[model samples]
Target: MTTINYISAVTQALEEEMERDEGVFVLGEDVGARGGVFRATEGLYERFGEERVLDTPLAESAIAGVGIGAAMYGMRPVAEMQFADFIFPAVNQIVSEAAKIRYRSNNDWEVPLTIRAPYGGGIHGALYHSQSVEAMFSSIPGLKVVIPSTPYDVKGLLKAAIRDNDPVLFFEHKKAYRLIKGEVPEGDDYTVPIGKADVKREGDDVTVITYGLCVHFALQAAEKLQEEGISTHILDLRTIYPMDRTGVVEAARRTGKVLLVTEDTKEGSVLNEAAAAIAEECLFDLDSPIERLAAPDVPAMPYAPPLEKTFMMNEDKVESAIRELAHF
Candidate 1:
């Protein structure tokens, strides 16, 4: 076991996977020489050489297009988007082409590609740098959406994403890149299965379901509520698309109350989807109305630090919401 930050864990996963499989290569803006905008791909170019680690043009569409073409031709490509907000330009290739290739070809073709990007607010990235795009891509079929909150989960899930047979959109919270730290297994084969939710904190009073950086806030709130005799269960939905319905339903049923949280705007967010699922499956078990804590539906993130703070979900907000739901 090794204690590492989220960014190092991601770099380790890419290095190990590339070493294990010769076909696995990485490409993106400034990924080769600059080692990525956030250094998530640092030291990879020196280790794997220029051929395997490529620095593509600034165009997002071309990056997605090249990744899809390479994946269909038997190479595993890990394409990085400088920021999650910039991935919009590649939607045509990602949604219309890479996502539908397998079904369109009658299972004759599979796009074993992973699109990695840093997302979420809290670093004061503002506007174009701090947008959450999970819901946009998760709604599409033939795609897996993954957002890891900790170093361990990021490393393991990234490896799983690289080895999977389908296309995956992997979102890493920008704030968590260095802020979150944990012990990761010191091996190349360690992998966390996709579509499974891990209970970060076990409780009985309320179940707080969340993902990405919100998982850390939920855990913090859970810890504080414990001092007041309120047990809050926190479930981190690492993989958003193939959501762990059974785990979500079970947590809701076990606690008899639920509080869904997300950093994205509330409307049509992943929290809404989870709340709807729990409402349908565990309606009888619910003791209180499902509460969702998310950012307001606004045009874009504010550049001001104070306004950004109000726009993002934090431990204080999470704790207040949990207290309300626990009392309900």
Candidate 2:
């Protein structure tokens, strides 16, 4: 096993995939030379060369459209959005074309494209650079949304995303690039299957369900709460769209208490869908009402430090929520 940071795991996954498959290529703004806006693609250009590691114009739509076209022709294209906030321009291309290609074509075409974007807050990236975009695309039928919380899963899920025979939106928390690290198996084909929730920590008093950076925050909060006799069962919804209903239901049933945490706004967030599932499947088993702790319903995250802290959810907030829910 090798211990690596989140960003290095991303670089490792890209390098391994490109080396493993000849058809796998990467394209996005500043991906080739600049090594991605966050350096997630650093050193890949030098190793893979220009043809395989492409740097396209700053056009998100074109990036998705071109990747979709390549995927249709049997090439696996990984398209990167400089920031999750700037992915709006590519929504039409991703949602309409890449998502519906296989279904619309009646299984005649397969868009094996993976879109990678750094998401979530905590680095003071503020409104423009920091945002959780998984919620927007998670409800879309054909697009699989994945948000990995650890270095190990980052490598595995990304490889799985590239190999998937459909469009996948893989969101990495910029906050966790270096902050989160874990031991990953140092070998090939270390891919974690999508659509499954991971049990990060197991407890019986209350269940904290979340994804992305929130998973790390909740785990920290769980440790603090354990001293107070509140044992939290943490579930990381690694893939939001094709949610692990079985896992969500099982976790909810185990504790009889649920607290959904996320960095996105409370309204129409991923937790809302999760809350519905718990209510539908494990309503009778729940001891308390499903509670949620998330960012405020502001237009966007504020740039000011004070305002950003207020808008962002953290370990303290998670612990407080878990403590309260455990008492309920």
Candidate 3:
């Protein structure tokens, strides 16, 4: 095992996949020369050359369109959207083409493509750069959505997504890219399957279900809760689309109480979906109403530190929710 950063894990996944499968390649803005805006693709251009690692125009639509067309031909393409917010321009291609191609055509053709992007608030990225758009794609039927909170999960889930025959939207929390570090299994063959929720921390008082940056936040809160004699279980929904509902239900049953947390706005958020699933599958086991702690529906992320802090969910908020649920 080797200790690596989240960005390094992602780069390793791409490089290994490219070596394993000739059809696996990367395309996006500044991917070939600049090695991506966040340097996630650094050193790739030199090894893979310009043909496999392409630098495209600034248009997201054009970049996504190319990936869709290539995937139709059975080539596994990983398209990088510079920022998660910028992916809006490619919504039609994602929802209408890449996502529905397999189902709409009755499995005759499948888009084995992965759309990679850095997301979430923090680092003072302001409104444009910091956004959690997972809910948008989670609502879609044909897309597989994944958000990894650690270097280990980032590497394993990315490889699994690449090998899968369906379209995947991979969200890399910008904050976790550098701040989070963990031991990733060595070698190129290691892979973690999609739709598995990891039990990040074990507890019996209450369960905190989340993904992305919130997973780390929930764990931090769980640590503090432990000190206060409130055992808080933390479940990281690593792959949100094909959600591990069974795992979530089991956690809830073990804890008897639930608190859902996420960086996205609470309204119609992915956490809400998880809570709803728990209610449907494990209502009899619930000791209290599932509490959801998330960002309020503000117009956009604020530039000021104080406002931005209030707009995002943190350890304090997560702990408060856990206390209420555990005592309810």
| TM agreement with the true structure for every prediction | 0.99, 0.99, 0.98
- Look at candidate 2 and tell me the lDDT of residue 75: 99
Regions of candidate 3 where Cα sits further than 4 Å from its true position: none
In model 2, the Cα lDDT at residue 61 comes to 96
Candidate 2, residue 51: how far the Cα is off, in Å? 0.2
Error of 1 at 125 (Å): 1.2
Candidate 1 lDDT tens digits, 1-328? 8899999999999999999999999999999989998999999999999999999989999999999999999999999999999999999999999999999999999999999999999888899998999999888899999999899999999999999999999999999999999999787479999999999999999999999999999998888889999999989999999789998999899888999999999898988778888989989998999998999999778889999999988999999999999888
lDDT of 3 by residue, 13-34 (tens): 9999999999999999999889
Tens digits of per-residue lDDT for model 2 on 1-328?
9899999999999999999999999999999888988899999999999999999998999999999999999999999998999999999999999989888999999999999999888788877888888888978899999999999999999999999999999999998998888999888568999999999999999999999999989999999998998899999999999899999999999999999999999999988888999999877898999998989898888899999988988999999999999888
Alpha-carbon error at 295 in model 2, in Å? 0.7
Clashes found in each candidate (C-alpha, N, C closer than 3 A) = 0, 0, 0
What is candidate 1's local distance difference test score? Answer: 0.93
Q: Each prediction's Cα RMSD?
A: 0.8, 0.8, 1.0
Candidate order, lDDT descending? 1, 2, 3
CA deviation > 4 Å runs, candidate 2: none
